[model samples]
Structures are given as C-alpha cells and as structure tokens.
Target: MKTGIAHLPLHGGKAPSWLFQRMKRLAREITIAVVSEYGPQEMLRRLSDPFWFQAFGCVLGFDWHSSGVTTTTCGALKEGMKGLEVELGLFIAGGKGGTSRKTPSEIIRAGGHLSCDPEKLVYASRMSAKVDSSAVQDGYQLYHHAFIFTKSGDWAVVQQGMNDASKYARRYHWLGSRVANFVVEPHQAICCDSRGDTLNMVAVASEEARQSAVILSQLKPGVLVGEIKKIQHLHLPSRHHVDIRDIHPDRLYKIFVKTYEQAPENFESLLGMEGVGPKTIRALALISEIVYGKSPSFHDPVRYSFAHGGKDGHPYPVDREVYDRTIEIFRNALRQAKVGNNEKVDA
Candidate 1:
C-alpha cells in the first residue's frame, strides 16, 4: 500500500523544556504500549510510516504540521529509547546536524552491542543519507537524520530536509523490508508541501537517465566540459528558466576531474565519491538528457495537518495544560499496562 504523506510549513525555535520533557515521557509510554502489544519490528514500521509518524508527534503535543515535528519527535525517541534498548531490542542512532554525521560510528557501536554486522549497518546508514541528499533532488537540504535498528538488524530511517527558499520541510521514510533498490523508488514515502519540477534521479522512470549518467561519468573531463559549454552558450526563449549559467562550470569541471581520476565503476560508486553532491548529480543527469537522449524524471516526488499546530500558533496554538493532560493519560495507561491491567488503557 502507498504510505500517506504530509505537507508541513517550516517553523523555528526549540521545543520548550517543560513540553519536551512531557513529550519524552509520553513518547516512552506510547512506545512501551506499542512494543508490548505488537512488537519492536512493528514499532519500527510504524515510525517509518509517514502518516503514523506525524500522528505520533502530534499525540506527544508537538506541532501537527510543522517541520519541528520531525526533529522533536526523533529527539524524544532517541532519549526515550535509551533505557529500553536491551528490553525492546531496538536502538536509535544519529540526529540533527553534526549528530547526523556521527550515525555510522553510532551504528557501529550499536552493532557491536547487538553482535550484528557493523560494516553492513554503517553502509546502510551512509547510503540512506546519500540516496535522499543526492538521488532525490527535492530542493530540501537534509539537516536531520535518524536511523533506527533492531538487534536482528531490521532498520528504518526517518529524515527531514529543509528548503529555505520555499519555507517548507520534506520528510523521507525508508524501511529495510520495502527497499528493493536504493537507487530507484526506495522511499516508503516522501512528505512535503510543494510539488513541482525536481530532477529525481531515483525515480523508477529515470533508469535510462541513471545508466546514461554512469556512462557520461566515464568520459574525459575536457569532453564533458565541452558538452556543458555547448548548453551554456545556448540562447533560448524567455520562458525557458533553465540557464546553464546556473551550472557552475568550475564545480562541474572539478567533479569531472575527480570522476576521471577515481574511475568509479558504477552509479553507486560515483555517488559515494566524496565530492559528488546534488548539483553534480543534477549536472550529470542534465547532460545525459541533452547529449544522450535520456531524460531524468522532473516530477517532484513529494507524495502529499496539525493537532493544536505549534506553540507560536502555526496550524493552531498549542494548549499547554491540555497537552499536559494528554501526556498524563498516556502515563497512567502505560503504568496500568506494565502491571498487567490494560482495562484503563483506553480510558
């Protein structure tokens, strides 16, 4: 089934201390309920589901339709899961900004504790980030990444990126079970507000373009730059907003030089190279389309609301006291469930 998506307006400011503490407590209780009822894997699957993830954030008193939901929820989960990792058999690694860069090491550490293959987990962590940042060109620069894994190595990824120009955030979801090809149609769901033109290299429709990009990468730097120059010098109608001027010749030249030196064996290797980024990928895809007759997917992959939205009144103003009451209810229910009494769980 196609997972549901959400469009969230970007908002700023940290979640207040009181609210965040309660959110952590509530998140922990709900996670306990879920794991107790279903299982750890089920909890991971639900977190990887965009709709359910958003709802989970809302239930914890976060903004229902703001970018903060992604960061705040993941932060809470990371904190709440600390003491439960061994019992629940799941671990959360990485987070916003610099913490995200530490994911591979974190995964390796967790893998060591679980006796799973650390190399494989590290690779998964890196590739998942690369796929979203490079393969999916949705204009959102990813700033947050969260990797969740079970002791058996079953994993899910939930990350968010922001586009300052549009003032919106996009969330990407991935499940290990659902991923057949990391290069194509790998996301379980991508949620964002805006949908327009995007150079989606990961789209199923872009297979030919991807192949052509690999072939183009094998060419000499001079030859590749020559072709780019041809497009750069072209004068088209006013309606054509695509300007080769936007393509940095120096950056492309550098990428081509690196590609020639490294001689990457495949698309994955090319993407894994240190200097390759969204712009580099886009240029290669564009060149493939113009020079090789293979067109990349231009369809923006954004597949598709708030409790009391946020504290600053985004979707709606956050009700502090009511939010506290909601957390209290979950706390009580969790306590009852722990003692073998679930009759009050719904009350």
Candidate 2:
C-alpha cells in the first residue's frame, strides 16, 4: 500500500466536550455505514489510509488542519466502538500518553475475545511503536498510538509524534496487509508538515546500514564508544548541520552496556530493547556510515498532505454550524437507512 503524508502544525488544547460527543456519534454512524456496506476489514483498510482518515476526521467536525485531529478522531473512534466489538468485529486499543503503553494488554484482551492470537497482536503493537520511534529518527517523539484491528488479525496503526522544537506533529499509518517488512517501508503513510533530513533505518536504502548497526551492537562498550568518538571528530569540523548532541559518549556507553547484556541477535531485537531509543539508533547508523561506508537513508518519508482545509481559515474556514448540521444529516440518513440492521439492500 502507498503511504500518505501530511504536514500539521502543532495545536494545543483539548477538543470541546460538546464537539467531541458529537464527533463520537458521527463517527459511530459513519463506521456502521461503512462496515455494513463494505465489511469490517474494508473499514479497517480505510482507517489505515492517511487521506481517508483525515477526511474522516473532517466529516466528524474537527479542525481539519489542527494536530488535534489525530488524537480527537481516534478518541472518538475508541469511545464509539465500545460495546460494539462483537457486532463490528473490530477493536481499538491505546491512546495518547499513558494510554498508549496499555496497548499490549488491551490487544491481548481484545484478541482473547475475538479468538485470535494475542501474542502476535501484542508483538505487532510493540514493533510498530519501536519502528516509528527508533528506526525512523524524524525528530518527532511519539506520544500517541492507536492500534485498530479486526477478528481475522488484520490490523492498522494510527500513531502521532511531536517535535517540541518545531511545534509540529507527524502521524504514522500502518496496515498489516501491506507490511512485508516491519523495519523497511512499514508505514502506509507518514503525515507531517515539514520535510528535512531524517535518519530512517526503515528505508529500503538503509539495508546495509541496518546490517552494519547489528554488527556494531555486538561489539564491546568501549569499542563502540571509541567508534562514536571517531565519528564525532570527523564530522565536528566539516559538518555544522549535523547534530552531535545525540552522540553523547555517556549515552552510547549505557546503550552499549545494555546491548552487551541483552546480546540482541539482530537489529530488530536491538531496537526492541528498552533504553535503545532514537539517539542510540542514530549513533549506530552514523558509525555504520563512517566505518563501513554503508550510508543510511536521510530522505524524509512523508508522502503528501492528509489534512483538509481548517476551520479557523487555514487553507479556508469551515463553518462550525454548517459542519455540525452536515454531521446530523448524515447520522440521521444512516439511521433511517437501517445500515447496521443487516436488512436486505434490495428491500
């Protein structure tokens, strides 16, 4: 599946309670309509599409361009889907901040209910987070993660990360059906506002770098620190743009110690370990490039815009009253159509 990307300026504040409640209702109605017509799996596929997800948030009456769209829309979906899992054959787990950490347990519970493999679902949840946070060093630190899945094990992930310095947020989308390699091109789309140099270990071009990093992981801590120092010395004079802040010797020492203790057999295992974050990942990639001449991918993976015109006149203003009325109309139509009643279409 092709990945979609959009740039969204970070906007603060919670979505108003009145608006959020309406959003939940509208989202539920829309989900019911979609599932009734296409099936649960199809709805999951659409949710995994960044463009469709952005549009879905717009139709539910959110600020089309605000970063709140990602959190609020997913929140609405989670609330709307409650108590309807059996009927819909789908589950949404995880949310912003602490809620995101609960995804594994939530997935396990949902999998048990659905008679699916809990272990596999849990692994997917963790790996998706790991790939985005460690493998793709795009400056944004992930804070929100939502995993959506169906009874048949088809899953999708909608997660957002924030770059505090830039005041921008990037959203990552994943579809299980499209993920051939979790470390390379795993995202169906990455939505962000700005594109710059990023250390993307998951890029197809970074295969050799990834391999080199794994090899580096097995080395002694002192050896890794020496390699990092050499890298720092070489780049310090010539490259002003390269940020060596992440190349701290102390941090590298700690990461190397952890690596030695864990003895990760592969790059994926190294990344999956605790304390192995973007800084460590970037350090290894740089070392790989410096020593082995295996350059990592620096290309930003963001594809295109997923946000609609904003309500506060960003690209254009959306009329709040009109937007609410539109939702009401759609919700009423879906109810009248008996969309979720499983009635005969011909009748």
Candidate 3:
C-alpha cells in the first residue's frame, strides 16, 4: 500500500468489513514496525501523518493518533468530574499521556515530587497517563486525570468537566493568595486499593452525563464499550496499550463481582460503596468480555486527524481512500522491522 491512502475521505461511519479487516491487519503490522524501529516516544515524535493514526482509531476505537489535548471526550470527562463532590487529586508524569516506556517505580518517584500526601502521591504515580485527557492552553498542558486512592489503597481514574458547564463553572480562578476564589464541592477525591487493582475516578455530576457517554457509544461505532476476545481492543493502538477509560458505575459494579469470582453478595457490596473505580472497571470490562461475550467500544473518539486539512485551511475530515492508503503504508513499513516475527505476524 502506498502513502496515498492518507488522502481518502473520513466520514463518521463504518468501512466495509473486508476493508476494515485489511485496515486492522495493516494497522497492527505498522504499529509493530514503528515500535520495533523507533520505540514508543520516538515513533510518537516522528510520525507526522495523522491520517494513518486516525484510521487506527477507527479500528482500535481509542485514538492512538494524538494526545488528549483539548478533546470533546475529555470535555465529557470534565462534565462528569464536575458533578462529583470531592477534592480532585490528580497523579501524572510529563512523559505520560500515551506512552509507557517508564517503569512503575520511575513513575511513582515523579509522583512523589508533585505532592506531600502519600495517598494522593502514590495513587497519582501508579496510574499511567496513557489514556489520561489533557489540554494545551496558553502554552501549558492541563492533564485531566486523577487517582482515586481509597482508604484501602485501591485506585480509579476520574475525567473532569461539568454537564453543561458555563463560564463561571468551567472557569477556575487563580486567586492571588494560596486559596482559590471558588470553592469546589465534594472536593474531587481519590483513593487506592492494595491488591494491584487500578481504581481511578472520572467524576460525573448527573445522570445526563452518564447518558451522554452511552449516547456517544450509540452514535459512533468505536466510541462506546470496546470489544472482547481481542486484547488490542482494550485501548487505542500505542506502545504500551494501556489507555482505559472511566467506566459507568452500574457497569463497574457488575464486572467486579463476576471477575473476582466473587459471590452475588460481594458484588452488591462493591456497589453502593465508594472508590470502586476505573482500574476496577477495567478488570470488569476485561472479565466480562473474556468470560462472557459482552464488549465495549475501543474506537478512538478523536475521530478527525490532527493533520486533516480543512477546505478553508482549518482541521476537518480528509478523503477516505487517501486515509486508507496512508495507514497501509505505515503498516507496510512496520513489516520491515526486526521485531519478533511471530509477534508481528500475530499483530
């Protein structure tokens, strides 16, 4: 495949199954090639073609093509975060967001530098920034991710925003003094579980926010719950493949009970409880799909490519055929890499 596929049009619809399958195969091959050649960070830096990654998003459901910089999905997370009443404590590293080349211990140390509270610090540190949402504004990147460390040392991810945030609500005032001008209710909070479970928080203030997420799934094929059976479907195509979204409460509760081999009583206990979060949800999502047939959306919601040129010199959708060819070229390049032949073949 040539690089011309990048020029194809991109509509918010599904491609033909045969084409979709070929795209999937090519995406995996290209991803492996990139990983073998440049490693994670270098690949991210070198790949200037957004169309290829965007097509990968269509296949993977998670947008592995770009960082979570100013996304509407992040906006959805923000709306969800605003609805909660807790002190929001976030944990992240600068290199985080879409790569996991760093070790767990390394990331934890970086988290320690950011905070004094061991709970918040540890929670923030253990959580990877792969799928964490962020926005670059005024020459700064605001990472919208958190670690909900429970009293038990468990954690979950929280994506923040208001349901229909107005200027006063979305706007955070930087008070001259140590304290800010506005007081946040419930104080976005995070806790952790000791059992190697990642429980993070994505705050949602209203049923509307939850419903909106469900709506996103309904409207877009790759936006909702991801597929089971395929491990790659867990997140968008990336180096580490660890971008897990904040799951719904009802869904979270269901997975926890089933996966741990817990009884119905234990399942009910997890629900109506606090701090059972994203890591837990991830565990559940994995278990449900692997053990059961249910699946979730893993398609990248950042549908349009960053490199997509608009008709009026703005960012808009590009040609479909061009996009496919572009993705194919990337995949072909990966095939030439010297990684594990079997692994490459599997991908």
Candidate 4:
C-alpha cells in the first residue's frame, strides 16, 4: 500500500508512543498484505532494493538500533541462514573531524558473538590487485585502498551509501519486523555490512530506481538484472557480480603503463596491478568496447541517483506551494508522534 502520514516521524530518529502504536498497526497490515500477495523469495527480492529497505528502516525506527545491526546482518549465517531480524543504518561523520574508527575487525567485534569457525574470523584487507586512480576531493591524491573481510561472521560494512547522511541507508528488514521468516537467508550473499568495509566479489545492487539505471547501463554495458526486465537476460542484482568476471589482468597492466605515458602523473604507480579502480576501469572498458567489442558491464554502481521519472511524474515543473504543503504535512505528523515535544523536536 502507498505509505501515508504514519510513515513519517518514524524515521527522523526517535518515534513517539502514539506514532509507534500506529506504525505497529500499519506494520501488521503490511505483513498480512505481503504474505497474502507474495511469496517469501519475492518479499526478500523486494527488500533487496536499498530504497525500499531504507523505507522499512524508517518504519522500524530506533528499536532497530538495539540489535547491533552488524550482528543480525551476518550472524544468521553461522546457523546456515541468510540474516537475522536486522536493521540497516546510514550515518555520516560530518564536522571537520567527524571521525569514524572501528576497522573491519573492530566492527565484527562490535557485532557480538559469532558461532562460525573462530579461526576463520580474522580477515585481512582484500586490496590484493592494486592500481591507482585520481579522485576529485579537496586535493587530488593517488588513492590505493584494498580492504577485505573474512566471510565467517554476522555483519559486514561498506564505505558509502545513497546519501552522505546515515539516516538514509538500506537493509533487508522483513516488512517492519526484524524477523527474517526464512529457513536459510544466505549470508555469503551480502556485499557490505555495518563496518564501512566490504568483502570480495559480493554482488551489490548496481543501481536503484528504473529509468536512470536503464539509461546508464545502456550507455555503458553490462548484463541487465533486477527490475529492468525490458533488457532481457537479467538477474536479481546482488553481491556476486564482483566475483565472476574480472578485467583482463594483462590488458589492465598494459593500460596502467600506457596511462602513465598519456597521463604520466596518474598512472605511474598503478602499473601491472590487478585492481585498477572504476575510473581507470571505465576508461579501459570504453576503449575495449569501442576498439574490440569487449564491453564491461555498464551498470551504475551508485545508489542515490534515480532511474525512472522523479516523484509523481507530473511532466511539468514542481510547484513550490505544493512542495511546502508536503513538508508541512510531514512536520505536523512528526509533531503527533509518541515522544515528548523535546525528543521529537531533536528527531
């Protein structure tokens, strides 16, 4: 069902009791609708989208925080399942030094006890294949980060999200409940967890929405998957895509050396490396497709951009008056939440 005013004040942080009760009722209705309309796998498939998952996170609210989202993410794996009743979070450390510690290992530690093989718990950074790429940050720097984690735990982490704020991240909440309601949830399938770190070859959703993803993939190249059925020959878009195919090592090494020749400053260090980043990879992929018909998958890995038409598809420019009305509706609904005026105010 289309979300209503109740979905608001649910996500901005804390939820008031009255709102919580209302959400609980909504969640029940949603649960019944989902079970009646779709099978378990279909439900799981829908949750895979970061946007849908983030919406569920908003509904689940702070109660989700107590579960050590890290653990519930992968813990079910040790028991031969997908994930536990879990919540996904997306937070940004702003400020000059809005710092975040907890390396991959530390994050796993924070995720509570693991039942998997203890020896397999310790993981090393997976930056084996090294190549240099230029990133446009404050200053240009030759970046080289090869981080990886052991596959024997209840949580994972990644470096970025759909937005800079943590409040809008994604996870696989089953409706509004943390419960997975499955026999085996598939642990090895997740790409990133709570650690801001990732594992090797885990299939990640290359994009969200419909139109932009279709355009981006069409403009580039890749086997279409998930909701883009028009392209045919597609899959559910998961973590394994990263593992199956690899950039030809020989071609990559040569490209790196040549890059130094063309743009000497950027390519000097990346020569003969295994993992040449997305930019260099894109450059090589472009040349390969143009010159040799060997095109890498043209999926847009970024999550924030849209795929289909923007909100409601009005075809005309949005009216500012309507926009304010929408915001005011939510603001008022937030006011009606369960927490006191103060907590809700901060929320």
The residue-by-residue lDDT of candidate 1 on 1-347, one tens digit each, is: 12334556898888989778877877888888788788888988998899889888877778777899899999998898778888888889999999999998888777656757877777777787888788777677899999888888878888888889888877878777676767877755556556755677888898998888888888899888888877777674453323457787666888898898888877878887888988778778878878987887777777714544465665567777777776677778878888889887856
**Backbone atom clashes (below 3 Å) for every candidate:** 1, 7, 73, 34
lDDT string, candidate 4, 24-88, tens digits: 44333333334334533344434433344434433322233222221221211122111321211
List candidate 4 segments past 4 Å from native. Answer: 1-56, 60-101, 107-275, 299-347
Which one wins on TM-score?
1
Q: lDDT per model, in order?
A: 0.79, 0.78, 0.30, 0.27
* Quality of model 2 by C-alpha lDDT: 0.78
What are the clashing pairs of model 2? 3-188, 4-189, 5-304, 6-191, 6-192, 7-192, 7-193
Question: What is the per-residue lDDT of model 2 for residues 1-347, given as tens digits with 9 covering 90 to 100?
Answer: 33555557799888777677777877887787788778888887888888888888877767776689899999999998889887888889999999999998898877657767878888888888888888887788899999988888888888888888888888888878887878877755555556766777888888998899988888889998988787766644332233776568766797798898778877778888888888888888878877898888877787623232354555555456766775676666666667454343323
Compare candidates 2 and 4 on TM-score and give the better one: 2
Worst 10 residues of 2 by lDDT: 304-313
Residue 123 of model 2, lDDT score: 84
After aligning candidate 3 to the native by TM-score, how far in Å is the CA of 327 from where it should be? 2.0
Model 3 scores a C-alpha lDDT of 0.30
Worst 10 residues of 1 by lDDT: 235-244
Candidate 4 has its poorest 10 consecutive residues by lDDT at 1-10
Candidate 3 deviant stretches above 4 angstroms? 1-30, 40-163, 167-316, 338-347
